[model samples]
Target chain A: MPAIEVRNLVKRFGSIVAVNGISLEIEYGEIFALLGPNGAGKTTTISILATLLKPTSGEAKINGYDVVKEAAKVRQSIGIVFQDPSLDDRLTARENLDIHGRLYHMSREERQRRIEEVLEMVELLDRADSIVKTFSGGMRRRLEIARGLMHKPKVLFLDEPTLGLDPQTRRHIWEYVEKLRDEGVTVLLTTHYMEEADYLADRIAIIDAGKIVAEGSPSELKDSVGGDIIKIKCSDAENMLKKLVSNGYDAMLVDDEIVIKAKEAEKMIPKIFAIADEEIKSITYKEPSLEDVFIHYTGKVFRDEEVDEIEASKMKWRMRR
Target chain B: MEDEKMISDIYAIYLREILRLWRQKVRLVTMIMMPLLWLGVIGNAFNSVMNLPTQGDFLSFLTPGILVMTMVFTATISGITTVFDREFGFLKEMLVTPIKRESILIGKMLGGVTQAVLQGILILILAIFMGVKFSGAMSIPGMFLTMFLVSIAFVSLGLAVASKITSMEGFQMVMNFMIQPMIFLSGAFYPTTFLPDWLKIMVKINPLTYGVDAMRYFAIGVNEFNIIADLLILLIFSITMILIGGHFFRKS
Candidate 1:
């Protein structure tokens, strides 16, 4: 049986439809990723599946338990790591995990054992005694992940688990996620980072405007975008895009850059330069990536430009507090 | 087995709240000291400034008022933890758990009651240093029981208010706006019998008035209103606030 099944799930906030008729299935022990840009309803979808938000219509089942009717069972089977920080900074890491275990009704002995095991699994046992407020961002994220695992949930939901982290820490979190998968824990993760999804997910579902635009394995999605992607930074990108399209090349303009997909992009680049020699200032060709697959399917550039702005405003608000 | 889990779920939330209270040393000190200051400064100021006929020492008469005031403020302020949890996202952590919703709400309310009761005890203890004595029909256990009932009622009111507020600063503003009027109008610093007709009506309407009056009847056995009637009103208010607060918290 699938670990999770979402059937036409819809969530509307007043006049706005945040998640509109979404559907997908995640198999047992599989590392599934929902990749989307900001406001693509990834977090909203995760919230519904985790039984935090009730769906406006349609249904979702977690571990064969209906999210709305058997919400308690769904909550029992799943653990969610929210995109925002949720740790009580005043509490020690161990205290935080202890509270979670107790909430799940684990005995003292069981709580102790599971807390230690998950703490060590996340490599946070060394800092378990210290208060969470004293920890760095990466350490806090690791501790949050450990807290989510303390209940031994069958399915773990990570909503942007490595968001706003440095490259090394992001890679470290990815390793822990891979380890969880090895232990047969079905993980449903959402990310806007194309490469994180490519590296971590067994299957990828690209969502845009609250709907799945594409779904496949990394290699399969990459192959679907043709052979190679040639990205060009030039003067008059609009003119460059028109010229490339008129010359029998499949190309599009994305955020002041021209991108083209061809069978042999390396050979086509020289001929393309022959047509718009002066306008093409810098030309770079690379093999197809999940990003190319996204642009190919969505017909628009996927950018999380609002993330940094939101983070900045949050920082300002915190400083004021 | 499931019943045992439900009990543990409530215990877990209660335990965390106690731990948080223990960790906040400054808050502990402030909650204790504020009431003592109110008792000492206000009791003396009223005694010397206003030579009111009828009582054996204004300090003794004022002790119950200060005790109730402390519980009211502490109880209401305790609800700010909910706002803090909501704003900081810790509430979401608890909400996502598989535990029953009633456990979470009741557990948090019990925790706040515990803290408010502790603050009330400290003030009652301070009454000893002020030369106030407990006597007449009200026993020491009875005073403690009155404080307990009053704490539950005010804390429920705080929780109901806190459930809707989003920010700590906003809650603080609400506390500032609501607390002064509630405390002053409740006859916490003076007898309601001597007040003007309009002010007496306002004091009668304030819920904390019955808490203070009953506490006075308990401490030094002075009765502004019938002790049994005061306790009955407090009981009704506590139940209603719990129902209302639980509804708001569940919706939140």
Candidate 2:
């Protein structure tokens, strides 16, 4: 059996069908990415497979144990790092691991050893006894990741693992994630960051609105849209879209930029740049971003809206224990 | 497999919760205040205003009810912390673990109930100084038994309500809607005999009414309701509330 299997999974919250019917299978010892925007159901799908959620209909299995019937077995095999930070600020990093270890029934000696290993793995050994509340956002996130791994779960789920971190910490987590994969753990994560996915994912499934729009290796997904991407920056892309189509070129208008695919960037550069003329202040060319691919399939990434203050307010709590 | 893990996890989580609350300054204030307010303020204020039958004094008869009511309120509001955890993703963090989901609520219940009951017990002692007398009516052990039963039943009722509400604001609103109503309607502040007929009927449906009635009867020799009937009804109320709380906790 595949290491993880989700078949025709569905989840609903009252009138909101958060996850439509979707299916996926992941092999052992591979790092797979579920790429999507806020409401894409990637987190919902992972939650079901992690045994944290029950599917409205259909089935999910982890290491051959049914998520519904054999949820205990599924949970034993999987570790989840949620989209938000879950560390207890009051506890020291070591204490956090110790508490989780106790939950898994780890012996005193065994848990102590595991704490050292995890702290070292996250490169936080020096700060192991420090309170988590005092730690930086990046450090807290890493501690959460370390705590998730204390049980030695075979399948690991990272839901937006590097979210809300600076690029430096994001890179640091990416390296640790690489180390886990090298150790033969099946790692699954959801990200909107194209570079993060391209740098780490063995295969990526592009999800949107509770459905998989595309699934393949990074190169394969990019290749699916045809050739290397050529972006034409202009004051207005509306007139340019008409110009490119009238000229028999399939160019997609993405905001102020026109993205087109061609066999060779060298030859297509002139024709694409000609459409913009003096209107083009400058032009640069790269292969394609998962963002580009997202735009290729969907309309826009709307990255600005992703970080609105409304999403931040959702994180507030009561006594904050 | 899940059940065993859940039970053990509940124990661990409950222990942690109790430890945290014991360390909290504000929680310490509230737990002590609820009982102190009754013994020092409410009990003293109504010392001679309302004439009620008491074995020794009004404060003595009123102490047990306030103790149980405090436990009931504390236990019910315990879910508010869990709601805070849920809203902040701490509860979700605990739930996603391979451990039993039932353990989450169970741990909260155990810790919350323990604190509440202990608080009530502390108040019971203070009541002695407040002119309330214990005639050694029942053995020390029997008094312990009575306290245990009352605490468990009321605490369970609190957990049942807390688990159903999601937000802290919503939880507080519902607690006000249900708790004060239960308190007045159940004779936590006054005697059930003083209540009219229709209210007396509603009192029968409330676990607190039966719990306080049995508690008062345990302290004094009077019985507005049959002692045997009250004890049996308390057991029923305790079990049913536990089941209901467990259901909503799992739903959560």
Candidate 3:
């Protein structure tokens, strides 16, 4: 049986349909990612699977227990790290983990043993007694992840796990998530970063506007974009796109650049330069990224304006530190 | 087995509140100091100006009222923790757990009750030190009972309000609007009998009126309503508050 299942799950807040007919089936010991931009209902879908919100229609199950009818059982089997920081800042890391264990009905010995194990897993054992409020942002996120793993849940949901963290911390968190897979835990994560999904997810569902636009492995999704992407910075991108399309090349204009997809794109670059020698200023060819895949499926650029602003400030703050 | 898990869950939540309270040394100091100022400074100021129909000295008459006031203040504002938890995102951690929602509500209410009762005891001790008289050693347990009942009722009311309000500022506005009226109308500062008919109706409806009256009977050998009637009304009020608070908390 699948570790997690959702069948056309729908959630509506009055007139606004937050999650519209979403379906997924995640196997045991696999890491799945729901990749989307902000407001694409990634968090809403996770909330439903975590049993925090009831679906407006359809069904969801965790470890064979219905999310609506057998919610307690489902809760017992799943742990979640929410998008926002949820730790009790006044408490120490160990106390936070201990309380989480107690909430799940773990005994004294079990909580003690598990707290050490999870803290060590997150490399926070040395700071177990330190108050969460005193810790940095990355430390707090690690502690929250440790707390989520304290109960040995069958499935773990990580909502934007490394959002706003520095590059080093993001990589560290990614490593921890990767380690969870080896422990035979079914993991479902949501992320707006295409690179994060590409690097970590075994399978990804590209979501936009409350619907899954595409779903597959990272390579599979990228391969579906058809061929290598050649991005051109030219004098007139609009005229260049028209010229390239008239020449029977599959190309489109993205922002200020004209992108063309072709087999053996390196060889086609010279032929493209021959088509519009003066119009093309500079051209670069590379393997199609998940971003290209998103654009291919949704016909829109993948961007999170709010997250980008926050990320930029956080990056600047980290650089200052 | 299920019952054991639920009890453990409640205990865990209760322990978190206790831990948070213990860590906040400044808050603890201020909670005790506020009541001291009211009992020491306000009580003396009121003693020179006001005359009561019953009891010896205004300090003795004011002790029970101040005790109830201390508990009511601490209990009602204790729900601010809930608002902070919601704003800080810790509420999601508790809600996603396997335990029943009622356990979380009960645990929080009990935590608030514990803080209020502890503050009540401290104020009671301070009042005794300040030359206030009581009905003797046996009334201590009865006084505690009165404090407990009053604490539970107001804590539930506070939690009920907190559950509906997502912002701390909104909760503060509502609390300021509601708490002042409840305290003033409960006869905490004066005798309910001397009030006009309309004011008397407000006192009759305020649950803290019975709590303060019962506390007065236990502490100063004073009587307004029957002691049994006081306890009965407080009990009913607590249960009703719990039900209403539970309904709102579960919905939230």
Candidate 4:
């Protein structure tokens, strides 16, 4: 059996069908990423698989245990790091891990030993005795990750693990996640960061509006869009687009820039200047990224959800905790 | 072995609440300070102006009433923490664990009862300094027993209300509207015998009235209602409230 299997899962919140008939299978010892923008149902799907929310229809299994029927076994097999911080602010880092260990019914000696190991794995041994309220945003997030690993779960779920963090901290979290995968732990993570999926995930699924638009390895997904992207910054982009298309070239205009797809962009670059004359100011060509693939499948740029002031403050409050 | 671990899980939740109460200075200070002001200012104001029922001073007669009121207030505050946990997402962490659901509510209810009883005892000790004696009508253990039962009932009552609300502000509004009327109808500040017929009927319907009546009998050897009947009423109220609270907690 696959390590994790989700078959036609559907979750509806009144009139809103957050997750609609999505299916996925993740093999053992694989680091899988569900890549999508906010409100794409990645979190909702993970919640159903983790047994935090029951599906309205269909089924999911973690380590061969049914998520809804054998929820206790599923809960015992999987660990989760939620999008929001879940650490108790008043407790020290060690105490928080200790409580989690107790809940999982780890013996006293094993609890003590595993707590130290997980703390060191997150590089938080020095601050283990301090209360969580005194830690920085990055430190608290690392501590939450450490707490989630205290139970030694077979499968781990990370929902937006490095959201709202600096570049250095995001890189730091990526190393620990890679280390977990190296130790043969199956990890399922959700994120919108294109570079993160490219750098870490062994397999990627691009989801939009509660459905998977495409699923493959990073290079495979990018290769699906076909050919290098050549973007020219010039005046009269609309006129240039029409000229290139009439000449049997796939070209389009995007925000004052003319873009074209070609198998050999090097040879195409000189031919493009012949049509432009003096209208071209600059030109650049690069391989298509996962972002381009997303646009290719959806026919639209990724539109980020707007965060209201109350939601922003709630995030700030959690970071403080 | 599984049973032992389950007990430890409950202990972890209980200790978490205790640590929170210790770190939160404002909650502890208010829990201690509220009863003192009530016993000092309100107890003194009624002493010289009003007639009393007990054989001693008005302060002595008012001590048990103050203890019961403190328990009720502290129990309500205890339940509000559940709403806070839900609002902040900490409750979700606890819910996703492998432990049983009933243990979560039981652990929380026990923590609330412990805090409420501790606050009630603190006031009882303070009352001794104001010349109220514990040996008046019941043994020291008897007074504590009555306090424990009343504390459990109120904590469960608070949990029942907390389970229905989602916000801290909303819980406070509901508590404010519910607590004052319960206090007045319990006859904490006056005797029910001298009241008019309708008011007496209101006191009879209030569950807290039996708790106060029982505590009054234990604290001063005086009975407004039968001792067995009062204790039974409080027992039935506690079980009913816990069932209601547990049902709502499972729904959430």
Tell me the fnat of candidate 4. 0.76
Which candidate gets the maximum lDDT versus the true structure? 3
In model 3 chain B, which range of ten residues has the least summed lDDT?
B131-140
CAPRI-style class, candidate 3: high
Clash pairs, candidate 4, are none
Please, what are the lDDT tens digits per residue for candidate 4 over residues A58-160? 9899999999999999999988998888888888999889888888888889999998999999999999889888998789888888887889888899998
A150 Cα displacement, candidate 2 (Å): 1.3
Models 1 onward score TM values of 0.95, 0.86, 0.95, 0.94
- Segments of candidate 1 deviating more than 4 angstroms: A233-243, A273-279, A315-321, B45-53
Summarize candidate 1's per-residue lDDT along A217-239 as a digit string, tens digits. Answer: 99989998989989899988888
Looking at candidate 1, what is the lDDT of residue A54?
A: 93
Ranking by lDDT: 3, 1, 4, 2
Best-first order by DockQ: 1, 3, 4, 2
Question: What TM-score does prediction 1 earn?
Answer: 0.95
True-structure Cα RMSD, model 1: 2.1
Interface-residue RMSD per candidate? 0.7, 1.9, 0.6, 1.1
State model 3's lDDT.
Answer: 0.89
Model 2 vs. true fold: TM:
0.86
- In order, candidate lDDTs are 0.87, 0.77, 0.89, 0.85
Clashing pairs in model 1, backbone N/Cα/C closer than 3 A = none
Best by DockQ: 1
lDDT value, residue B181 of candidate 4? 86
Is 2 or 3 the stronger prediction by lDDT?
3
